[model samples]
Target: MLILTHTLHLNRPSGKVPIEIRLYQPLPTGASWICNFEIDWPEVRLARHGVGEDALQALVIALQVIGAQIYTSPYHEDGSLRAYDREDGYGFPVPSNLRDLLIGVDKMSF
Candidate 1:
């Protein structure tokens, strides 16, 4: 159970504020996600502000895309909301299954 963490920073060419996204897999969720399949993907996205169902669905989609065992987190009230950073910027632990979505997962200093 390696904790693969990454970050999401979606930027708009129009200069609009970028939408931060955080997505991970191997979630501790006891749902049927485990019996799905093996995930080789490496990128994830979160709701950040009000992505709503899209964000949540995106998580499940990402996981199901490759097939990962969702790890449940007692501290994770709403994993999607974790994308946006209230103080500075949004931050989320990158998941190996969704790391491909990240612009620069390896360059991430944090």
Candidate 2:
């Protein structure tokens, strides 16, 4: 089992804020891998589960779901929140190691 914890910064026009997200395979409470998320905006706190052959695969699935939600968020549609784009000058940089890990995974379903 592997545990990954990362802080996502939402670069909203108002300012940047951090959201805490964690993924753990074979969750401490159950048999499945779980993604736990907390966001200050709209005050959301929830967890979701995914299935995969290994911890990294499971982590990718969880990330896909989380990312989907982010895309669908109001922030995305309004252009208030933007991802790391060099020209746009928005969003924060993801840690190097984490960026490499995410880049290694091909986009997949949850």
Candidate 3:
């Protein structure tokens, strides 16, 4: 089942590229939940999973992982980004500003 779908408009020197991020329902694995996600890029697609304590946590972790990938990847002169198929251990850290842009502010309060 699909949980959430978000579109991010990445600005490049050439123009803006719309990237679609989709989060799917997490499945239980032992004591953790594994969330599956897909990032639809211009010419390539990325499919990965994240493990967390619960469904929401799993989805958040998946997004964080994807954000890290985007932050670490090299950009072309035109400002277009590249994504690798394999994972890089302890990838580059995502800045707060980028995180806010990607995940947005949490409006919910206790």
> Relative to the true structure, how large is the alpha-carbon lDDT of every model?
0.32, 0.48, 0.61
> With candidate 1 superimposed using the best TM-score fit, by how many Å does residue 33's alpha carbon deviate from the native?
2.8
Best by lDDT: 3
Indicate which candidate wins on TM-score. 3
TM-scores, all candidates, are 0.20, 0.50, 0.58
- Candidate 2, lDDT over the whole model: 0.48
* Model 1 root-mean-square deviation: 14.0
Off by over 4 Å in 1: 1-14, 34-60, 63-110
Clashes of each: 26, 0, 0
lDDT of 3 by residue, 58-94 (tens): 8677767766656544532233542322322222224
Using alpha carbons, what is the TM-score of model 1? 0.20
* Pick by TM-score: 1 or 3, better one: 3
lDDT tens digits by residue: candidate 1, 1-110: 33334433233345323332233443333333321122221243322211113435545455333211222321122233122344322233344654443332222622
Clashing pairs in 3: none
